[model samples]
Target: MGGAGNPDGPTLGGDDVRILLVDDEIDLADVVSLHLEQRRESFSVTTAIGGNDALSTFESTEIDCVVSDYEMPGMDGLALLRELHQRDQSVPFILYTGRGSEEIASEAISAGVTDYLQKRATSDQYAVLANRIENAVARHRSERARQETELRYQNLVEASPHAIFVHRGPNILYANDSVVDLLDIDDRTEIYGTDPLSYVHPDDRDRIDRRMRKAFDERETADWAGWRLRRDDGEIRHVESRGAPVSYDGQPAVQVVLRDVTDQRRREQRLEALNDATRELLTAETPEAVAQVAVEVVESVFDEPFVAIWSYRPETDQLTTLAVTEAATERAAAERNEPRPVDTVGGDLEMDVFAAGEPRVIEGYADHDDAMTEAFETVFMLPLDEHGLLSVASVEPRTFSAAERDLLGILARSVVAAFDRLAA
Candidate 1:
């Protein structure tokens, strides 16, 4: 038999404490194990005849605490304590024996024994041992739980995509990898212990400071707001940030999460500009006016200013250049003197997309056509529903993103509506 089992079965709700009871006398070990189990429903005691047997049981089982006799054959309580600590230094070990003295207590204390209890004839001594076991086990479990929680938090902070930084008052305490990348810095230590507001744009510093102060004073979460961050290279980046009160190094601090929103904010502004252009398109009196508005809108919305619009005359079957941005005119100055015919077999990508009634993105346009200039690398050819074709070219080879294509579609439809209104 292993030892005395709890008469009421294993303790419910994971409160079971597996205690290893070791003694040279098998009968005394069994009696002590039975008393511990009988005293607490959560205690399930296992007996070992000697130190070697206790070590074997400890290695095989998940023991929370070890209670061993001071005097035993082969290995005494102190030796067993050393052996058990070698395996798990944190596991609680108690020295319980009848031969107890001040010298033995001091030696056990020096040996890192959790508790030393003197054995007595009265059964009341078991109650004292049971209390010490529970107290030591409780402390051990709590420490393990705390360590696990810290490990999980550390992993989560490092893996987060958003730039996270903790600061107490004006001093930055910690920054994650994303923060280092966002600031365009090679090392995170460069910003640690530095004032976080030093990176904020001068125009946004006062406003952000007020929000941070309110969050820290009230210990409340600060709402998300847009702020301009000046990177180490002196480039301004737009970000949306929110702050929540947290404890860092046992002191109150604020954890701020910054999401890079520079691209998103630019897209929103471009959409707003397009909306304004749509109003202008509706007021145009002719197809040429519509083409003029379309070219202007494309030039303003895209980073590439090389945009042009051509009006298709079905009767003459000719493509007439109605409008072109200043950048496009400068880039195609030589071609402006001699325009290519739409009926040509080659080097007429714009006419091909217009006739096909579909939009096309052509990369390396310079390579595709002998007539095309090397100044333009990529071109977006979009049809304006038989009214005309619109072309936007860039010096860099790039395909328009889906959102960019959607904006172009909106502009094209608005131009078509203007043409229909003029025809009516």
Candidate 2:
């Protein structure tokens, strides 16, 4: 048997291994415990005279492995094995006995013993027992670490807010809760094993496919790219996503995280269109020209059909409509029998916003008792400094988001700058 003197003997180094040695023969147990400790400097051995003392010691101390004799006074090694397993099923237990036979070895295996060794007169037997103890302890620690790592990964994936999915080849392997909600699906099972590219817009599929291929084939991370996602109901949503090569269930796959950017993209497009309109506003030489640019910008960028601009007249204490969109004209055509008054402005809402030089958004404008409110449900009144007021109204109820309001403010300032240039 390979002992401490053998160069290739089993050796373990790191944290100390706590071992509980149990035998009715006190001298035999002490000698075996001493030999094990001398063979491996990392081993710390504790001795117990019988099964009852072994149980008491096990409960008090954190023992990594147990090396016990077969026969004892009240509780035998097999009886102690059952009690120890009830507390911790994974702890390593080895049966080292003098009366070893096929009957005892078979019985120890049935009781879930980690290892079995027959006692011998030779002193070298302790070295072999030490090697078995080291192997069992190493395996136990590795398995525990793996279970902890998997538990943490599961918790992180479930708590993430962004849509995450793993795909191998063309089939989806895993998808989180956010993915189901993003696709507008009632169940996640519907997405599993299905092609991920089927949900992508027709125009964007080829580009997304290329990016995913690069990620998997090159084993590199794909940079974020914007794409249109077509939902189950045929609604289109704008999303940005990044992908990286990952190992899923022992196979190479790609894990992608998708973030919804529909609202952000729409705001960016509106700002770009507004910037173009600002260039047009700079060319206007008169207030009426400035109002035309404002009307067109509001109609096109905001998708609001009913838009009107009013010029303030201090001498008459009134606001007269200087420019209106085609939709606005069509809306008022049914009520306009005679030439409207030059001072005929909108209701008190417009007058208040103009007088205060502040913007106001009125939802349910159709409920107001005003001539212009008859056909519109929402109205956004923005004052162009002291020059005039710009109003964009919708037929359906609408509430402008804070970002939309900021964009509208930028439009108002552009018009004010144009008016200042005209005055100069």
Candidate 3:
């Protein structure tokens, strides 16, 4: 037994539990504070003479628990409990009083009291109250820590830009907001409890499933680069994805993080293709030989059936076909003797582009010449300085994206350089 001035109590640890002791009677409050202070190793007690004073102390200080007398001149323990609940329900409150009644106990319970103790002089009464206070405070701290940890994890997941998913076996348990955007989904509920592999491209689904299973079974990690993921819109995008075994809902699950790498992969492939095409064009001895090499490389790299290179005749002011894909060789040969006007191509904007020395992309092929009729719905044309024109066509509409146009422009530049060397 020790008072605030006594040193007979246990030594306090670095992290001491702070407590607020409230009672209208100054003597009773002092006695309770002394008992708590005796456990100086665990508790640091702050005394409040009344409920109002207790409220003020609670606000200004960081208190772990509130121990209050039932009846006071200003506010009873029940009223104090109501006020405390309104402010924060997380702080543990215990009602310690000499008053006794089952109705009073029931009322305290209904008001959300953390613990109730009947005041007595049995010598061990304070010991029992002290135990109750310690237990309640410990539980509250533990729960608050857990909630804060969970909140932090949730915030991190929400803020991440990469798509993330949690899955058990094959069933998806959760998908973050970024996953919704990546998959073009309206609601997360649409993916919950569904197989995550369902969205993977059919060609890659089996491989991804195998990797996922191996990671889960062995509790290892797996990763994939340049894999295809088919979105809800049926468009396939390249992604670099990783998977690791994680705990979800108290069970072993797989956490997947996927990042779209379509543009990056395309750029890499385009660079490689351009290098190959430039190497081929560099070996040509004549402009016609350069056209043959350029058209062949473009066709092989793009996998398109329609590719042609025209040689500009300065005297005739015409662009005549020099090289054409075999599938369109007959059609191109028929127009070889004829000169297509440099100003316009099938009433399209290629005329302005030819004059401006820029690339022209016919996304819909709506204004192409008669020679291209029923041949292609999309066309990408770039002038090779005053040497000739390099054009690639696809039967599918809208096949010429910005990326494709840029890649072709690069190829045109290389071709123009080769033509200049030949003319030299």
Candidate 4:
């Protein structure tokens, strides 16, 4: 080295760090190496005569950071930065240049330089470079870890089975695979940045909106169960969901996870309807009054157009209508006041249930009888033991599930018990 560094200057000593110093000036490079060597316990510095030499050194040796002169022969610092990025973008590169300018700084930044420092004649310049190198490397490591974490979260959300959505206020930012399937959507692009509340059922929108906003404001999680949602195809569904305040894409937002629970909710409502009917059945004074209340309770939980109760007299072997729903009364021309013997009526599901004293379920009733005047698509008949049978009819095909079958069976037993009590 041509000149010696000041011994009085602050020592650049701390944790051991590997640094690659690049400069074309052999004398300057030697001088800088000498200065760094004085603090050899803290820093292990290697010198490169130019950018090409720096690249070779980078490939062969492990380097925590690169400090290079912007103006150099053969390859410059900016070119060296590009080469280092192609090999490994994580290593920090600093442009310590004598020809410092706004244009150079901008160009170096665009080339992905970590830090820019102007060359000074003072011996303390090396100390400054040492500090800058430590900071730049620390920052780069931290950012890399953050990016890795975010990538992992993204992958998890994409593969989730439940409908997962992230929203800021009313606008939806992201949605998962299940959301597309639940909404019956072909493309996900249509969902981004749209108001999430627009997809909610008319009756449930306000409640969900309030919950989401409250969760965001409180910075806590909010859970909502048995919420109705209208799909893109205009069919209603139920969902249980939870929302929490989270940082998404560096912005304050709420992340929501929705689980489709339409089947579960329907089962719950059917149970509730059965309980309601049981309460009404216990208080009923007459069998006719019991039939009317049962029809009302069952009809409240189902989207059926018609419901009726028929009393079965074993002595006469006849089926007589005790009560009919309002819709049933409106649809039929005359009151079915004329009692018909079980053998006289056609051999349909209704007659079969009465004869066997077992429940009967029919799907697509029109298929069974094309000439059928009844507009209903599905029908169910549950025998009320020795008293009568309950009939439920829906305009939608295959509307009742297995859970409904079990629930309806329980309700039928309750009605029978109530009838036996009143008779005794």
Candidate 5:
């Protein structure tokens, strides 16, 4: 809806355009309906006895546009027009009356008449009556675009990797490049006059109709997510689809954006599978079961048994090894399962990390004494829960920098949050 001039639309015919015809002369209103029908601009034509009747019809039905004679009984076209504008200023209204003076034309135009025509004029003189409707349709589209562009049209379109398009009542007036390239399609002209759903997966057709109806009725954005779409080559892919109500060629249908998310979806599916497998392992009732799950998760993320989980003793300010799981080859007997005070091996490491109430990275084990260096090379102490740290250790005698510390912090927070939720 943004960053562009008004898109020109084809003439309106057999369109779902609701037009209220207001005239005291029933015969002239009938004649006008006949011509408009041929043009197919208005799907339904309603005849009113006067301005009052026109106003009543408008109140009852969802009128798309209005047409009225200047002179009428009870209320004149000018007065009715002022009322209509007050009710809804955006709706298009054309004045068709015997009054044709330049002064009246200017006044009528200023009064918000989309177009003005004299009843005395012959049919040939109003050949562009259809054109007038078409222009009003274009203006309506411009208005809609004006509102949407204020949000993020380019960003939304750019956000999607797939093609995007718009389908008017009977024409395809717009398309984005990625969509064009995906179908191996040539130009927008190739898809013009084509049924938009013809490319849609048959399974999604019903949903598409429902979505379209909701969007049209509410005048809001509509979307169909992760629906299967078929390309010209008969290839099908998962796509997120969206459409907005827009005037196409002086009529209404939809402006649509399509995105390809097959690759992203696939990655998500894989991640989900990995997470599920890890969850199943971690749910073990025994420490042995927990160790296995921990090993798998650590292996997937790091190179070796660089992970050591601890249970916190707040009173003693100590970290005791609850268990040790290794992904890489182990140098010590993990089965010994001996518990040691965290401060003994890494002086004040557990207390410092806990008191910090956040993640801390120890760059060099040598920064501490021999006991700390002998315990581990480099340690990233990330608080797993309220008091404990899930220490990721490296045997290479290194230090964890700010960047690594931040990444570990996020991961540790996730684990802590999960545990907190479980307890809650």
Candidate 6:
């Protein structure tokens, strides 16, 4: 234990050490300050006359530790301890006075006082007082460090977007803030130490239970993807949950992280709906109708500005111009590069999309080859029933994404299906 030193003293960590002394007797504070100064201790000491003055001084100064008297005029030391505890439980408080009693000592200890000291007969006893203050300050620093570490851990768990949970044996001991928010629970207590499956939808519980059993028996990581968790509000949440064995409470436990895929699945459903509509148009009696439907589907569902459908003449097997709605606003940017009407749908590029049965994003068609630069700024081409390819041109470069490619493929499947229906 070390007593605080003078202000601007050489501290180990290059930070100032502050000690606050509170007592009604003005001479006592002066005497203690003088004894510590003579001892040449490493602390910056500040003095206060009474409880009111002590609290005011504490507010204005950075007091590492507080030493106060039990009996004060305005407020008692116990009340001060209670208030200080509320503000900072780690900051230590020492009670030293002539009125030391067993009852007072126990009460002070209960109220969060660090040390209780009795009045000494000789003035030299102030050295012992300084030593006790130092010990109190050291203990407070240790406690503050521990508290900060705990807070950092808690903040990490609470702030993570992925839901993290601790499950000991078969019970869920803790869930991160995201998990609580996902389950729509008000407090950690509501979710603690219960089987995670209790919150799982009945349809998914068996599979989840089996996975847990496998994890425990094999001591392997458990993966539970695409399960429905029933929320407190009675809504089912689609989530991907994973559990792995980790150390918790000095024993093996399951650590779980949950990722939400609700939006992804919703987008998939929308794609399917758009694909269904494209299928309907593909079967529409004639190639012209198929072209019109493809164009309409792109405009209506994809909200794309440009659409074109090319057809290869059955007799010649050469690409023939079908239908194209020249996007008025985007036309200038594309037209500037193409000196021609892009009238020729050459055999090589035409067969590429239809044969591959996949779409490609061509950025600056001119860069793809001098031949394509004639009419397209950027082009995404999807095949149509092996007869020809459906190519959509946009002035915007790289407008099509990977998901958009899947979307076009789905539309191509519908086109293939419609072609079969029309051929029949």
Return the lDDT, model 4, position 125: 84
Best by TM-score: 1
Worst 10 residues of 5 by lDDT: 1-10
Per-residue accuracy of model 1 over 372-409 as CA lDDT, tens digit each: 45657898888888787788888788889998888888
Q: Candidate 1, which segments miss by more than 4 Å at Cα? A: 1-14, 23-35, 68-90, 95-125, 146-219, 229-237, 241-263, 282-293, 329-346, 369-371, 418-424
Tens digit of lDDT per residue, candidate 5, span 252-308? 657777777765675455456456654654455554344345545554643446566
**lDDT (C-alpha) at residue 170 in model 4:** 76
Candidate 6 wrong stretches, greater than 4 Å: 1-16, 34-41, 72-76, 79-90, 122-132, 146-159, 166-177, 180-193, 197-255, 261-408, 414-424
Full candidate order by lDDT, most accurate first: 2, 1, 3, 4, 6, 5
Name model 5 segments beyond 4 Å from true: 1-10, 39-43, 141-424
Off by over 4 Å in 2: 1-13, 20-32, 47-58, 66-128, 147-199, 213-218, 231-233, 245-259, 280-293, 304-307, 320-344, 362-378, 393-399, 417-424
Q: Which ten residues in a row have the lowest lDDT in candidate 6?
A: 1-10
Give Cα distance to truth, residue 110, candidate 1, Å.
8.1
Give a tens-digit lDDT track for model 6, residues 1-424. Answer: 1236433222234344587888899998888877765654466778899888888888787888888888888788888878777767778788987897899988987887889998878965676776677667766676677667656766887888998888765688877878877877888788787888887899999998887776666779986677888887888878898878765554667778898776577567768777678756754888677767777777766777677777767787667657665562246345566534545455466566666776766677745553344445687777676667777777656677677777777776776676667767
The C-alpha local distance difference test score for the whole of candidate 2 amounts to: 0.86
Candidate 2 C-alpha lDDT tens digits along 153-239: 657877999999989879998888999889989888898998889989999999999998999899899999999999989999999
The best candidate by lDDT is: 2
Number of the candidate with higher TM-score, 5 or 6: 6
Clash tally, candidates in order: 0, 0, 3, 0, 7, 9
TM-score of every model versus the real structure:
0.72, 0.70, 0.66, 0.67, 0.38, 0.50
Could you tell me the TM-score of candidate 3?
0.66
